[model samples]
Target: MTPPPGPPPLPELHWLEQLIERGHPHLQAREMRRIHVPGGPSFPVHAITLGNPDPALPAVGYFGGVHGLERIGAEVVIAFLQNIVTRLAWDTGLHRLLEQVRLVFMPIVNPGGMWAATRANPRGVDLMRNAPIDARERVPYLLGGQRLSAGLPWYRGRLGDPLEAESQALCELVQAELLGRPFSIALDCHSGFGISDRLWFPFAHTREPMPHLAEVQVLKTLFDQSHSHHPYIIEPQSAQYLAHGDLWDHLYLQACENTGRTFLPLTLEMGSWLWVKKNPRQLFSRKGIFNPQIGHRQQRVLRRHLALLDFLARAASSHERWRPPSDDRAQHHAQALAQWFPT
Candidate 1:
């Protein structure tokens, strides 16, 4: 008798597992949740931590695969992790850096979606749009998140329901590993939106600038001073378009509720349009639209973003040196408001 074929495997998970094996004694991998795909085998969502574990130390988080189609995002993160692991044997500076800063990696957040080749998980919820937050201002129909049906893109989970397991797991990890610290940053990677790479901060639910706008401006200034030729368009997520149930927005708000915590959550939206423009045939393929289909381009993409990731680690570790003082906070806030909130 002929047996039914099984669902395709998740290559990202395999690659991450390999890294865990090689990073032994330096890396710590924890299973956040086990996702069972309907008619498919279950896959584990992992959170890999390294560096300082003390609550007093600053931390940075690297996340990817929020949308399963954006394989390039996950690849970029994995490449950076691999680079770090390879350097563990001889990088004294890295060991020194680890003494002061903690690092977290959840390179593949939607393993089921990656396995199923869909944006949403097997439960059909868009994890990014599955948070409890809602947009106060008008948002574009459907693109901003909709409750019409799970069949649609950007579908928020059912009203009045708790978050999906994946969403809950991510939140739990962030709250415990990041929010408790005095300073921390999160970079969630995604692609397939525009023609240029973008580094977006919170308030995707509205155009209102967040309280940390001044800090963001300072971070941008620091990034520009360091990487003069970088291509990212650093701005608020609402500057592009507002969306409902943004997980970062919810998490950032939660961080704000604490009296002295500073959490800067960023979204790395790697534009796929340029890739499609360079190779127009990519438009015909669904995966290609969200990823670099060509080999050299993929390698270039992986190589280019590693610097940004490293910069984030360095920035978090030395935040005390560069963070704006009370005397300059108002000036930065004024400039930021003028730049992003011009009426």
Candidate 2:
């Protein structure tokens, strides 16, 4: 008898497991959930955590591979994790930083989708669109998420049904590891949006600015002051398009439910169109649309985002120092409104 074949094995998953083995004594890897394909093998969803566990301390979460087609996002996160694990051997500064903040990584959130080369999970649900949210404003036909058939892209799972397993895993992880903290920042990476890289904050369901717009603005200001020449269009997700069932938006809302807690989630939308522009042949490859097809280009993409990931961790550890006092928050809000939500 022939056994049913599972999706081809995922390279990212293998590399991540290896890092976990090597990162022992410094990092902890837990299999949060396992999703079994209806007729094939199952895959594990992992949450890698390090640093202080105190809920009073700040934290940062690095997430990637929500959409299976965007393998580069997962690769970027894995590269960063590998860098940290390698440094755990003797980097005094990194070790000290780890003591002050909690850092979590879910580098490959949708392994089944990645292995199958589909944007949606094995059950045909788009994890990003599987949250329970609806747009207050008009959304693009399908890109903004839909309750249509699973055969279509950006399909939100059946209404009134529990979230897809991958979505549930992310939500549960964020609620447990992030929402209860004093402060936390989450960065979810993806690509294939435009020619310029973008850093988007929440309220993807509406154009209205989020309550923590002032805090987000200040963080952007700090980054700009330090990096000086970084190339990223920092803005709210609504500025580009509105979407229904955005997982980050859903999680941010949950964090907001806690009084006195500050949770800022950022989505890194890398611009892969330029890769296609540079190599016209990428237009013909499925991976090329959402990732850098050339070997060197892929490496460069990985290198480019490492600093940003590290910066978020550093910023989270020192958020209290950079976030303004109540007396000054109004000014920050005013500035943010003028720049991002001007009348």
Q: Given candidate 2, what's the lDDT at residue 215?
A: 97
Candidate 2's C-alpha runs over 4 A off are 1-8
Error of 2 at 162 (Å): 0.5
Q: Which segments of candidate 1 are over 4 A away from where they belong?
A: 1-8
Model 1, span 1-343: residue lDDT tens: 9635773377778888899999998999999999999888899989999999999999999999988889888888899999999999999999999999999999989889987778998889899898999999999999999999999998998999999988988999999899999999999989988899999998899888999888999999999999999999999999989999999999999999996889999999999999989999987886769999899999999998999999999999999998888899899999999998898
Q: After superposition, how far is residue 150 of candidate 1 from its true place, in Å?
A: 0.6
**Residue 26 displacement (Å), model 2:** 1.0
What digit string (tens of lDDT, one per residue) describes model 2 on residues 1-343?
Answer: 9744884377789899999999997888899889787776688999999999999999999999999999999999999999999999999999999999999999999988988888999989999888898999899999999887999999998999998889888888899999899899999999989999999999899999899988999999999998888989999999999999999999998888876999999999999899989998987886758989999999999999888999999999999899988999899999999999989
